[model samples]
Target: MRRSTGHPRVRWSRRGAAGLVVLLALALLAGCAAGPSQRPPVAVRGELLPAAPPPPAAQAPADPDRLPEAEPLRSGPPFADCTDDVLAGLAAAGTPVPEGRTLRIGCGRLTVPADRNRPDLGPARLGLTKVTAPGAPADLPALVVLGDTGVDGSARAAARLAAQLPDPVLQRYQVIGMDRRGTGEDLLDCAPADARAALLDAGPERGDEAAMSALLERSRSIVQDCYLLLGGQLTSFKAAGSADDVEALRTTLGLARLNLIGVGDGADAAAGWVAGHPGAVGRVVLDGPGDPTLDEPARTEAVTAAAESAFDAFAGACATGPDCPLGPDPRASVRRLVDRLSGTALPVGDGDSLTAGATLRAVRTLLSQPSRWPELQTALAQADAGDGAGLARLLAPLGGPQGRFDAALATRCNDSRVRATPGEAAARAADWDERFPLFGVAAAQDLVACGPWPSGGQVAPATPQGSALPPVLVLGTAQDPRAPQSGAERTAEQLGNGRLVRWEGAGTGAYPRTPCVNAVVGRALLEGRAPAEPVVCPP
Candidate 1:
């Protein structure tokens, strides 16, 4: 993926601390009943039920128990003292380190048994990277950044953030990036490539029993293969199990408190962290948030609708701009493109082509960032002219590209529960198609791919436990097509000391890059100041 171009240039102010504090305080007072709950229509109709309750919270596991224990925060003398050691290692690897910067980072492999559910099995070596900050304060916070699909970007992002942090803040903490259970260097050799290919071939349009059965078989094969490859080491790799992995990493690093930085499915892991290790968590910043507890069909529908809505917004904007390449009526142009693209396959590039399924996938990716709307509009215009090159370019990682589809599919399937039978999946997909006419058919098919996966894992119900920790900042873009603004508001209400900071635009919370939002989070973390008023960011 291309590096995010342009530094965030928004102004910052320390004066906003008091206001943030007040706002957070009020939000905490309002509590869970303060916000509206948009229950799914299916829930109201008794067609679905909530997930089962999670395991009871207790002390960290003290033995080689079946279940993994909670991870601890890393602590010791300031990381600066060890910088030379870290830098030398990086130098050996030919990785660049700025002058005057010591690479106080360490790499280690932890041998935790394959499956926590079966602790008697031999251990698997999980890879971990730790960076220490020099002169860290005695009471400074420690952060654990969770890796998403590919471990590369997250590792780089964490290292860069550590390097950029103020010395004082750096001295107060260390950052640790842990590869999830089955990804990165810890990837299992037995992972079936064919299973992944099978699911991908099923396409995003398959909503029938035959297609779903094929998808399920692939999912089941992957799970069994993973287990066998790991020597029956892990039965399943779910978010809850991954949370345990995080805790283990914390203990190894000697951290006293955890500040979880989660992205995408990592957000689910963060929530699992809070639920499993409540008091030990210092803070949480969940980017690209998703509700894991939502029923499969409901969550799929929500995401698909959000994508369509975002596309409509972009089209509307393009139609109003005279410079827009999609003629004077971009909205109509978008609809036309959608109609033509849906269920239609067109050559995209030298070897790749735009299938109906891939088109929606591209649209979903573009909707993730509002700033890219103009680019997407232009790409649509180009596609309208029968040249799919622009659209193909936009499909790249930075624009809308994805990593190995097989990996993503495998990871997602392992992380969630799926339908039991092809028949059931088909029926559900058909129902969803009617309900979400725009994106439902594809969404349903996407979920069906998991039907054949292992039937059981450690599934956790959504139990929002209010934190006694300091007030935490939660940000949500009003037009976020992935994690809806409403979910952010719901999360704020659920947390005891929470504040909803709103950025009224699309995509995940743009706080890290936005000086204003970052300032708020930084002050909150440093001074325990809550936002006094809702931060309603303007378009």
Candidate 2:
């Protein structure tokens, strides 16, 4: 019930305890292959910016707290050395056919030890892509980083932001994305093609001890299998490995300093790296990160509260509309919808049936992006009217998170040293069920998905403090369920030099949610005087 604080886990796309072990072999996500240029992973002139947002009948008031003014770039030096015109020309000319997962971007494979702390561990390859900022001075160093969740398409994030970032932002730095150790070219996937469906069906059922036990056993087996299959290679997939890989990336690019931007768990990876090599990081920004300071139980609690709050916000938004399918009592309608579908399958278009699991997944997906709320309302209406087609459409493209479920489990487990037996997980879920209804218990159970796995991350992140690096800006979404604002607050608090900027709005990293939020971040990075205190950005 407490305010959530954790990873930018869309927790959104991942399925439950069911046959989550069915990881198929490593390959690029369906649409992520480099045959052609598709859209990219993420960034913003917009955080999936809205187009002329319609004025709500009753908009929330802006924060009454004092806001800080941004200072100029005071960092030691730029991360790159390149003329803005040359950079801009590259962008305008379009990304060339990339060498890895994406097309027309700066793709290169960087080699690092599978475990950097242990060089004798041998070499590992990291797939990385760079989107050169349009006008960056070749002599002025700059780099913006996007986390590569094996599932999120490592370079996709860089690709998405390359086009959306303001000219000024792009002109100053090159956006970089590297496939987390396991996902992209270095894929170690074991997830099945029907992995999503299997997980949905086999994941622990709320309040069912037998189901949860089964899930736990399966989970343990999955981890054991992974170890057997991957050997010590699995060790390299941990957060520490990723962080080291990042450091290696800078070395390969020959950048003296990296202006880091981390999204979700990517924040953790960046912070971890900064913690060790503070000298290598110049200006840093963490948006919607998973703070290592939180333990497993706390993470679940935070995620549960955040998710419920977000759902409420969404339902409230819909209820205000006279024709809302969820009716005037959106919360009740949501509960009813879930209850009614317990065992029944609604006939979707084309003779396919929609299960309760699929419905939940669809809702989760819509919740990930505030801009998608309208579509959610429509989907609900359509489902209520006996046609599950809309819901089906929403579920079809969603895989489990930015990385596959198994990879997420591996990375999460390694990061979190929390260990619980299946029975304990079920107990936690049972307790959370009352405090958080629909999402609370399920998430709690999911938190321990790696309980059965024996190996843990190489190093649990230290207190989000001690980075010799300059103060990094931390952005949090007050209502985000996936990446709670609390984590951001802690990240800012823990860092030797960190500042918190809170945005009361929709979206994971609400960078472009409002002019004010973007302005704060933009000015901080470009001009570069770190804000000394926390500031609240309005929706």
Candidate 3:
């Protein structure tokens, strides 16, 4: 097994300010997902496609059931014991922690090659956190939880997940959270304050030819700036590299097998790890995984449709609920408010103006977390009343350096070989605007931002091999605005040993939300078996 006592304190390096300017633009664009475009048959070369083959398919493991009977846990080399420091750092970073949890939280950092193939570039560090409930056994199996691609707070995400999980599961496993590359001290933040303000304050008008052209150019600039900032190390942050890091972490921990719970882009890393290291798989769960097969256009359309459905659901709930802010006709109220805002910006504090684009972005974000739907309704009500502060606060978290647009764009573009032309992208956004007006243009604009990204050494989504692997559980939410239910269903079908569990609820994920869904997950993880028939939990 790989071993390490700990890594020495390493000084941080800040990239040029130019990179921050580009990242700010990209990050803002990613939030509202509004970008520039042009009308031409010509395909712009955004990402460079370097030749790289997929990881070799590993043979089936000798033991199909890698989970061992309760036994003494093996003690290997000690990893960095930074638990207290990590907790303090998380608090300082303002990562949201679930309230009133008494779990023991341990933290550490693992230094791995920046690029295993290019070790001369030095090493990159991955932050780690272990959460265990009181009286949990020392010999319990390890279950690693992965966060979404956009955020660098997987450890916090794990803590939140731990707080929601059933007591029995918590007592039976030591939950672990591993940060993706470019998190913590490695975060890049150098954008000028004025530049960031300009992006946030300005209106992202959809279907404007000038706005489209400028966005396309900005995409190119961000890609160029990223390459200049990261150079050879840029490719090291790809999803495949993250997969390798997972393997390294597993080996370093001296675990015969590592169970995993991956959400959103994190699911991609888990799938990649399973593809490369099949023998190490124990139990796996993919929560709302994106469909890797779809190109930009198809993916956007599906997402837009999902958003339309979720909004309708939200509107319906509001209509039926007492004292609803949206009045009797919530959909009509939303359309009127959007039209008013699009024509004239609502003045929020700090000179920032709330536009229709930002409002829709906030709506989408709120839709992903159903618990916050009340906040969305109130924000809309205030926006209609000419108070944009609520909406601007909603957009704040979606923008800035903390969103990690630089890392997200690089990883997303690097994972896919798909590149769409400027004209094709713009035309799709226009079509979406006409069809799914509320979220169509904003969501569709995402297609153009990645066009200028350099794409050499990209790794396609892992194609799972071997049928004898243990069952992998995939959870899907009925009204997931980001990743649609169809995509999750398809993902479950794509995996060799995949099982589908549907939650008839509105949210980005299902696990630990409903007792019915949690029971299904608990059974699968603890007993290493899944229901023969697909399970659907009611809202």
Candidate 4:
């Protein structure tokens, strides 16, 4: 929800289909998963127990990683009409779709209302790509793949998805990926470069009342600049509108039911979809899901703890690694490094210096991907040797190839109305040093980024819909630094037929990283059945 971590490279949420990209890379790894000796153990459940604990007695030897054999590409002529032409064609027709050749798979755009309530306000173009059902299309639900946040640059996401899909799935359903409304070619990059930089420089200046006031004013100014830059488009960039857009897409595609799968913040949109069309959706999947009902302090605190747990896991592994740059006491090394940075910034690159915010962001980014643990160790080691670019690579201003910064922030601010005042926010910030120590203050600082958000005239994304629908598969990667397992567990417990599938791992690769996970998900998707009870897959 914060702009500081806009770059997707370091985020728990990656480019393209956030869930699918991670899954594909992970599944490839799982086909030949390495042994414990080669893989660093990240905390998937709770705090770290020991550094480099002995391998399990029954552990089996691992095979070298190999490229997964690609699914046989279907041979066919591409879609007759482009996405825009197809949308226009559908609109010109009535309820029934054209017979010869409907939408197959190609790039297109959907013109949806900028604001659902104000249809006369004109429409925003949403980027889209559709993979039509292969061979004789079945009367199966279409798979609508969603990116975590409202980020774009996922023109290739569909291809990546096509590669990972089980052969059975490709023939049955059409897989769709959207660029939301204000992404892809329609992205709004109005915030001056300096404005985004300033956004990341937000902090309460050690909780000084005067400094807090200055920071609040600066925050307000940035928010105002964005509001103006968005040109009244801010209010409509929320999840509620995006949810309506999803419905429009469904109507455009002429599908009776959609297999809704939302990842990370995209879960909010999926929740909104179900809330609005409870009986219309089928096979709901929320991977790396977030709880829509969680309020502040608790939500921030939960996130902070989750992050620290992951960091501890990484620290433990790093301490045990023979050439660990963090030395024997990784925690102490980090504390000293942070303290040194707080006193004076380190030159990162091109005369740019690493600030506390950038440093923390770099650390958090590295912690999200356990596969990058060695890089984190190296970054720390490089910092000890007076080079900061290794960490600064994460904090550079960008969502890079996979983000729509303006839209992402708007989605958050428009929906989430922070009630904490500057003084109260400062109080929270002051307590973070004691509350969570490592990530607490930064977590609290993240909350302030939402301070300048408008309160009224915004609609809640989800309605009070019944959970008495079809069984939903919620995959929770334990010890996930961003979307922890507890949220997924709670979501499943709340649903009418929701089933919790636990994948014991630190990062967000539970579904694709474990062979058993792939089997479970493939069964659910192909056979239309999830385990009757909650299932657990141990690493």
Question: Which model is ahead, 2 or 4, in terms of TM-score?
Answer: 2
Q: In model 1, what lDDT does residue 7 have?
A: 17
- Candidate 2 residue lDDT tens string, 167-263: 6776666566676766554554433333334344332255466666666666665655555444455555677777876776655444556667777
What is the lDDT, from 0 to 100, of the residue 41 in candidate 3?
23
- Residue lDDT tens for model 3, 179-253: 777644345332233322333333335555555565566666665544544556666666688788778767665
Q: Rank all candidate structures by their lDDT, best first, as comma-separated numbers.
A: 3, 2, 4, 1
- TM-score for each predicted model, relative to the true structure: 0.66, 0.74, 0.80, 0.72
Task: Quantify all predictions' global Cα lDDT against the true fold.
Answer: 0.53, 0.58, 0.64, 0.56
Model 4: lowest-lDDT 10 consecutive positions: 37-46
Worst 10 residues of 1 by lDDT: 8-17
Over the stretch 199-318, how does candidate 1's per-residue lDDT look in tens digits? 433444577888777776776776565443343333445567667766665554454456666655555566666655665555566555554445565666666666666666776677
**Stretches > 4 Å off in candidate 2:** 1-104, 117-123, 132-140, 148-151, 184-188, 192-196, 202-205, 321-325, 347-353, 396-403, 458-467
Best candidate, TM-score: 3
Error of 1 at 103 (Å): 11
Model 2 Cα displacement at 58 (Å)? 50
